[model samples]
Target: MRETLRVQLWPLPTLGVALAAVAGVGLPQLDARIQLDPPTWLKTYLFSGGPDAARSVLSAIAGSLVTVTALTFSLTVLTLQLASSQFSPRLLRTFTADRHVQATLALFLTTFTFALTVLRTVRTGKDEQTEFVPQISVTVALLLTLASLLALVLFLSHLARELRIETMMRSVHSATVHTIHRLLPQQQDTAGRDSAAGNASGATPEPPANALPLTVSASGFLTSMDEKALLRAAVEADAVVLIDRTPGDSLVAGTPVGVAWPRPGTHLSSEARARLVGRAAAAVSIGPERTDREDVAFGIRQLTDIATKALSPGINDPTTAVHALAHSSALLCELAGRDLGPRMLHDDQQRLRVVLRRPDLDELVTLAVAQPLRYGAGEPAVLARIAALLRELAWTAPPDRHPPIAGALARLRSTIDGQDLDDTEHVRLVELTRLAEEALAGRWPPGR
Candidate 1:
């Protein structure tokens, strides 16, 4: 629920509108209650206009604000369209989740709503009633107008900065790094590596001959799983559940996403089987789009999309591709030091209850490297960046995890060999490959 709200543009603005509405209603009544004359200093800040003039002031403020609100909304929509078309559509989440943009829009709409609300209180002498104007409310509306103007300027500058590829890549990288830390923390020791990868606590469980398939009921991306709930269900059913789909994997309706079986010497009754299947299905959440909350690969996917898109013929921008890869390199290097294992949830007696599938280093390395290599094969700069990525990962990865880095470096070498490069470019790439090889061998060369 929180994640859904974060990526939306309406909630904050709606709250702002509600608060403004409340203030608009309550402030007018306060103005009516304060019958005493204000001090000279306080009077100076209050609205001094007569009822007719106050109406004109508020009408003008409300009218101008409506136009400004429309303009702001239009600019925001255009920015979203630009981001979606020029960059990956997945980046639309980043733009929509921007707090500055949301706050600016909220301020504008709130000011407009407040002006309109306060406008109705302005009254001229008529029907034997005295002249009345919400002096304090009108003053606040004026102040808010000034604030909205300043916010508009600041929002323009912020939006411009956000449009840059460097800023976008940095945001994606930061978010990805956060997901990595949350989902795959660094392992201080090699203890339990096998169990971390889904082996049972005592011994590897044989594949149950009567394993019941956990079919996916809806078609969408697997967004999250309630592991505790799944573990509890497995414990209650006296079964072992293996979820083969990771958070970012796409699911088709009615397809088996995993398998569950009763532990050895146990049998599931018909009711228990049905209950287990229902609980297993309910534990997994699917959404129309992927989120990075539990999926580290989503960030890598975004970065790869940017690099590959930049390398496309329509936008032949290799420098941008290199910059994107630099960010990707940081994420991959971080992942190398951490334990990328399938999550295993256990019962009180230390028996594995649930095995959740996750991508290991090799799969993530391929995710971060493959598409860019295929698209940027002819571009020597991109190939060099790929080589550098391997070098960096090689330095961070443990010996057991070096094979993926070496495999990627080998592929980079193959790509560089296929490229039509001048002598200097060829030498640079060859040198990078050699440095990566040295790094893999626990040798550190001097300055890059």
Candidate 2:
């Protein structure tokens, strides 16, 4: 019942009752004076033998009562209509949608209500016939004017703030999206181009001048060759080759591998080539085939690209890119027959182990170790040794032993005091030290 009254009948009825009570109190006195009426008691009290002031007072009171009741009823109806039309849900939503505007409106309404009460008191004097039309009109006009000014200021301020926020959000969102897009491809291309350019520069001062650029596809005899021997042969022949290994191809311990580039006008007899291939085949034990080398290489390239892009300023930490490179390096080693086994394959696991056991083997350490070696030594002897140890570890060790290997490598890094050696010599020593550590940890020796 209370809910129903609150929702349906309370507000308008209360306002009406209040208006009626006000009219009843003020109008009677004013009307009595206007109509020249007096009550019988009042006439006796003032002048016992004179005209009947009671009649004039009563007539004025009745007339004023009628006028005031009619005016109040008209005003109430008009107010309700105006409220319904101008302050409809849709219009009110638009007006009070802004917090500032809503606050200003509340202030104006409160002031107007106070002003109305003041106007009523000042205009309704003791005389029953006194008119309050001017005061009422002026009060209403003042209220409306104040409301208009408040609404205008609030609406303008709200619109300006809204526009500013929207513009800022849009600009920031666009910039972020655009930056990400631009950076992704740029990173990929940058890494690829840099690698390709580095390879093209052919800056490594290594021997073996009869090098041919050999490109081997996956479905060839190259898949069956011993990776170590192939790399050695390539180094001997001064050849640059791309080896494509199918994912999960079990590599035998000893198999002839790699595409060979014969010297110009110095083609080898098939028998001689076969002999070289057979000798090359006698090197390392192969693993169970799981993934293709080409696919692995492609994945590594993609990851490298992503990392490079993510490393851009304002995108992600540069260490992220370095970590990516480390992961790719590990994968590439495996694809190139230098696997670190399954346990060390995952970056997080590998990183955790490195952190707990070999904390010195951070991204910076890897970069410092890898950059000079990769760039300075092209097909160096130490690299071959490192590659051979990596292959041995992958074949022999369990997945969990990667941490110890990482620890060993870190130990090796610490041993290298800062010494002023030539670039090639320095890189060679670093590579040799790293390979020795890997071999010692994995219980492997040269030619094992």
Candidate 3:
């Protein structure tokens, strides 16, 4: 729920409208109760108009704000369209999640609501009633209008900056980094090193002969999971739950997403198995779209999308592709120092209860490299960036983690070999490949 709200546009604006409604309705009543004598200078800032003039002023403000609000919405939609077409459809979330854009729309709508609400309170003497005007309310509406105007100017400038490819890539990078820190903890503790054998690092553990298949209830991308619930379910059933699907994996209804097996020497009953299946299914969340909340690969996929789009013949923007690769490289290097294996959850008894699959370094490296290699094979600049990426990852990776980088580096070499580059470009690429190899060998700066 939090992840869904974070990437949405309506929450902020809707809250603004509700607050504006309260202030609009409540402030006038307060003005009606309290009377004040103001100095000439103070009165100048306040609304000094008659009921007729106040009505005209409020009406103008409300009408103009409506138009401005419409314009802001139109511009936002247009930006979404351009981002979808020019970059990747996945990038639309980045623009929608922008707080600045959301706040600007909220400001516009708030002002409009306030103006209209205050406008209705302006009363020119009728039916022998005394003439009334909400001086403070009208004054606030004026100030809000001015603030809205300033916001309009700032929003236009912000939208322009956001349209740049560099800015977009940086936004994706920053958001992905936040997701990484939130989901993938650093393996600085010894306990973190105890990855299941044959699972991710060591030999794979086989399920019990009577292990039961666990199927998904819905068809969608596996977005997130409640680990505690899974653990509880496993403990109650006296079994180990192995989740075969990770965040960002597409799940199908009635398809086995994992397996549940009873602990060694334990007999399984049908009732417990049914309860475990229901609880486990409830603990996992599936959505139509992938979110960065728990899925590190989604970010890499977005970056790769940007790189491939830039490399397309229609765009032919090698520089942009290189920039995207740089971001991907940074993410991959960060992943290198962390554990990229199946996450094991244990009960209070120190027994493993749940095992969740995650993308390892090899899978992520390929995700970040494969498309660019295939699309930008002929571009020497793109090839060099990929080589630099591998070198950087190699620098931070442990010896065991070097194989994925080496595999990617080998592919880089093969791509370079296939490119019809001149002697100069070919040699530069070869030098980069050599540097990457040296880095993998625990050597840096060659002679140093």
| Residue-level lDDT for 32 in candidate 1 | 87
* lDDT of candidate model 1 versus the reference: 0.87
C-alpha lDDT of residue 383 in model 2: 38
Q: Return whichever of 1 and 2 wins on lDDT.
A: 1
lDDT of 3 by residue, 181-232 (tens): 8777675542534333212233335787668988889999999988888988
- Against the hidden reference, what TM-scores do the models get? 0.95, 0.19, 0.94
As a whole number from 0 to 100, the lDDT of residue 236 in candidate 3 is 92
lDDT of 2 by residue, 309-355 (tens): 43444454444344444444444333322221111001212111000
lDDT of 1 by residue, 96-183 (tens): 9899999998998899889989988888989988788889999999999999999989988998899888899999999999998877
Which residue pairs of candidate 1 clash? none
Model 3 TM? 0.94
The alpha-carbon deviation from the true structure for residue 435 of candidate 2, after best TM-score superposition, in angstroms, is 13
Candidates arranged by TM-score, highest first: 1, 3, 2
